[model samples]
Target chain A: MKSILTEQQLEITIKRLAHQVLENHVDLTNTVLIGLQPRGVFLSDQLVDEIKKETSTEKIQYGKLDITFYRDDIRKELHIANRTDIPFSIEGKNVVLIDDVLYTGRTIRAALDALLDFGRPEKVELCVLIDRRFSRQLPIHPDYTGKSIDAIVSQKVKVFWKNRDGKDEVCLVND
Target chain B: MSLSTRHLLGIKDLTVDDISLILETAEQFKEVLQRPVKKVPSLRDVTIVNLFYENSTRTRFSFELAEKRLSADTINFAVSGSSAAKGETLLDTVRNILSMKVDMVVMRHSASGAPHFLAQHIPAAIINAGDGVNEHPTQGLLDAFSMRKKLGKLEGLKVAIIGDIMHSRVAMSNIYLLNKMGAKVTVCGPPTLIPKYIRESFGVEVNYNLKETLEWCDVANVLRIQLERQNQVLFSSLREYNIAYGVKRKLLDNLNKEIVVMHPGPINRGVELDSDVADSKQSIILQQVENGVAVRMAVLYLLSGRNPGNN
Candidate 1:
């Protein structure tokens, strides 16, 4: 196992990602943040907290989306669904789709399909804590990334959250 | 997680975990139903067939809507106009349909254990819509879903299954499910309508008094009088039965506390459930119909997830 980002580094990277999101959106009046369900929620939750702390505002439009129903590979295996609580409308607003890791890009593909069902957004952006470069199966690229790493297909990149995993770190594990 | 059994022949065959998983999955589908699109691509690649050897309205349409909402291709078969009327056997009918590459079968038959019989011979996963007076597993599931959604829990909840228990597949399924989920159940109706060994066999309370039953339960699942299924005169007449056992507004109003009212529908208003009580705020009859679609969707989706080769 190779450690990519330690606990302190993960905190700094999250703060940097929050600032980058705020810099792009300015006041975030027409923007919304959506965390992908199951694993991606940890990153998005912390990112939203950091954004709130920086802006000194608790009115950030945020929600969670579960894309299990929109996956193209559903026939291959069964996936249990999670709660989807996108309470606010995303119509004509800039939406940021957040997740923990980006690889193969199939999840992002399914997420995009799931998002269009809510309402047509003005634009959709991708934000991730770790981006596994050179391994995407689709043309999806992240607008804000905490770290970019190059790994082979067999290697797995996992992001550990303090709230769930008892630590905040990113690691590359070889089988 | 996946269901323990591939075929939903009856609620008697399900574990509490299976019931909970299905209801939990149904909760997700219920949210999907509230969305703008109200459809999903989870079962787009699968095809299902609804074989109704018996007549139906809610179960048939609920299963059809559930299949369509999941983007599944469905074929509806009614015994009246089908080859069955031309003296075809059940096995031959299903075999012919299987040749069309169908993945699942939702069947309602007048013969008990019909779906179980089909499951033994067919490669397709079978969901028993209602088999004789045996079990309507989906209706049982939706009832539990509606109860939990309203009362917020199932364990230790007092539920009374009122009216025609001897001929009610819904009651059988509900009793099996409620017992497995740790809920308290009582079969309430006329003495001749409820089965004799029900109290001993299913470990449920049996009541002959309608008003007493209503006051002692948290939810009352009143069933329609299956007059067609009854060969002998179980009661003097419809009016006599209504006066003795019908869930009238006057009786419900006399209860010390409000209790949820549910019916498996096609309600014989004034005979089993009065129209005023059926339309009352405490009645989740319409929400039961709405949840029926989601519950059936969960069943179909989960059963379809099993290995296709095995199914």
Candidate 2:
């Protein structure tokens, strides 16, 4: 296992990502942040917290999306679904999708399909903590990224959160 | 996580974990129904057939809608117009359908253990819609879902299944499920309508007085009088039964506290449940019907994901 980002680095990277998101959608009037379910929620939750702390605004239109039903590979395996709480409307707003890691791009593909079901958004942007380079199976790229790493197909990228994993770090593990 | 069993033949065959998994999954599907596009592609690659050897309204439509919502191709077969009317056997009918590459079978029949019989012979997963007076597993599941949604939890909750218990597959399923989930259940109705060994066999309280049962429970699930299923005279008449055991508004008004009312529909209003009580705010009868689709969706989705070798 190789540590890509330590505790201190992960914290700083999250703060930077929050600031980047704020800089793009100032005051976040019509902008919404959606976190993908199961694993990506940790990163999105942290990012939403940081954004709230910086802006002192608690009215951020944040939501959680579960794309288990929209996956193209559902026939191969069955995935248990998680709660999807989008209390606000995302009809014509700019949406930022947050996740922990970006690889293969299939989850993002499914996420996009799931998002369109809510309503058509003005624009949709992707944000991730780590971008695994040279391993995407689909044509998807992150608009805001914390760290970019190059890893082989066999290596697994795992992001650990303090809330869920008892630590904040990113590691690339080899089987 | 997948269910422990390959087929949903009865609530008697499910563990607490399996029931929890199904109810939890149904909660998610209920949210999907509120969205603009109330459909998912989870079972797009699969095909299912609904074989109803008995007459049905809500169960048939609920299963069909659940299948369509999951994007599964479905074929509806009623015994009235089907080849089964031409003196075809049950196994022969299923075998012919299986040859068409169907993945799952949703079946209802007047014969007890019909789905169980089909499951033994076919490679496809079987979901017993309702098998004679045996078990309607999906109805049992949706009832649990509605109760949990309303009452918050099932543990230690007092539920009374009132009406014709002897002929209700819903009653059997509910009793098994409620018992497994740590809920207290009582079968309340005319003494003749309820079985003799119910208390000893299922460990549920048996009540002959309707008003006493209503006052002692948190939820009252009144069942319709299955007149067609009764072979002998269980009661004097419909009027006599209503006066003795019908859930009337006057009786509900006399209760010290409010209790939820539920009915598996095609309600013989004024017989088992009065129209006013059935249409009251406490009645989750319609919500039970609405939740039917989601609960069925959860069942189909979970069973379809079973390992091929597992079945």
Candidate 3:
């Protein structure tokens, strides 16, 4: 059978991560999970679904962050960024930021700067599905990680979801 | 042999072979127009849509006449009084119109890649009438087509695009197409209006003085002064701009007399070019407008996948 993560393994991993979050974080009232654009939104939703299934309630809220304009490289040119529509309010919430793959942590830095425009959060904790911690430029670390892989910068690791391609698997492509 | 695919989004998308094929086909269409009846049976049953977001009466009329002369039905959709003002996105409007089963779409928009974006999604063949400052492939083709006729061959011809380099889509398109056609191109304008890295990127010379550029060129293609461009802080004043960059009678006399002058209309009569020069023996401005219809007709028929007369 050709599989990256078996259906049984993915279900077990979600439950484990939910229990880990519950053990560390006590306040669930004002807690929110915000996802980075594209794949991060999908991972955040999966985490939220697992938390709801375990607790039997929708106590947490979700939002999306688009950091296209906030990046340092876009300073020289015109700053007309792509769509950044956050439907839910994030004022004074305990936020858990989620992403699919974390490489240089520059995207997170850009997202953090963009988030300050909306409102300051009580706290911001980073969560990533696959953390290839080889190229770390900033003093940033993921609090909760699904898996960590040792790899060089010349390769790219892709996390496949069933919603995207009917499966959950990670593959490294030559960059 | 027929040209392979449809959709003319950029000159970058055209292969060298495809460029030659279009020029050759346009030559045939030009011949057909010179007859007693200035009409062809090339695209009889096809319907062409002139969907222009920008206000260009000259370009719009040219495309309309091009389709009509080719025996194709044409619908002119000007942006001012259209459903676009009712808060509909361009793609949504195009898709709704495409459902009517139009054969080809000739689009002119202020946004650079808007026509290319439409080409990717829409089922109908696309002809980029004009995009922002990015490209105007048909204008490039017609300019090159007209230049080739005068010079006999594009190889070793020195062509300079004078005035408004920054805001001129005509200049950008000509630089790429003329270079591809093997003519050495030079862009001359003020440093503020000219992009910083144009010379390094296109391998073309950039000069601030028109006299220096014209001395080395066989053809000088002058661009119009867009007053709205001044509002965008591209330049400061019109009077200063015309005195510095405008090509007048005195300037024309300074150039090589064999140097042909051309402008894409509607020209600013006294701003970028002198009215006498535009109306002179050296000017191919009127010839360019006349050739525009035939060139566009060839493009429509070629992209439509219909035989020139078999349709």
Kindly report, for each predicted structure in the order presented, the TM-score of its chain A compared with the true chain A.
Answer: 0.98, 0.98, 0.85
**lDDT tens digits, residues B1-311, model 3?**
54656688878777777788788767756755654446644456678889999988768888898888877888889888999989889999899887786778999999999998997887788888888888888888888888888778888889989888888788878888877878899988889888899999988999999778878888889987766656566667767778888777888786656688888877887777878888999899888888888688777766764423212
DockQ metric for all predictions: 0.68, 0.66, 0.00
DockQ of 3: 0.00
**Taking the tens digit of each residue's C-alpha lDDT, what string does model 1 give over B1-311?**
68899899999999999999999999999999988889998888889999999999999999999999999999999999899999999999999998998999999999999999999998899999999999999999999999999999999999999999999999999999999999999998889998999999999999898888898999999999999999999999999999999898999989999999999989998899889999999899999999999999999999984575643
Which scores better on DockQ, 1 or 3? 1
Share of native interface contacts present in candidate 2:
0.75
Alpha carbon deviation, residue A68, candidate 2 (Å): 0.7
Provide TM-scores for the models. Answer: 0.98, 0.98, 0.62
By DockQ: ranked, best first = 1, 2, 3
lDDT of 1: 0.94
Tell how far residue B185 is off in model 3, in angstroms: 0.3
In candidate 3, stretches whose alpha carbon ends up further than 4 angstroms from where it belongs are A1-175, B306-311
**Docking band of candidate 3:** incorrect
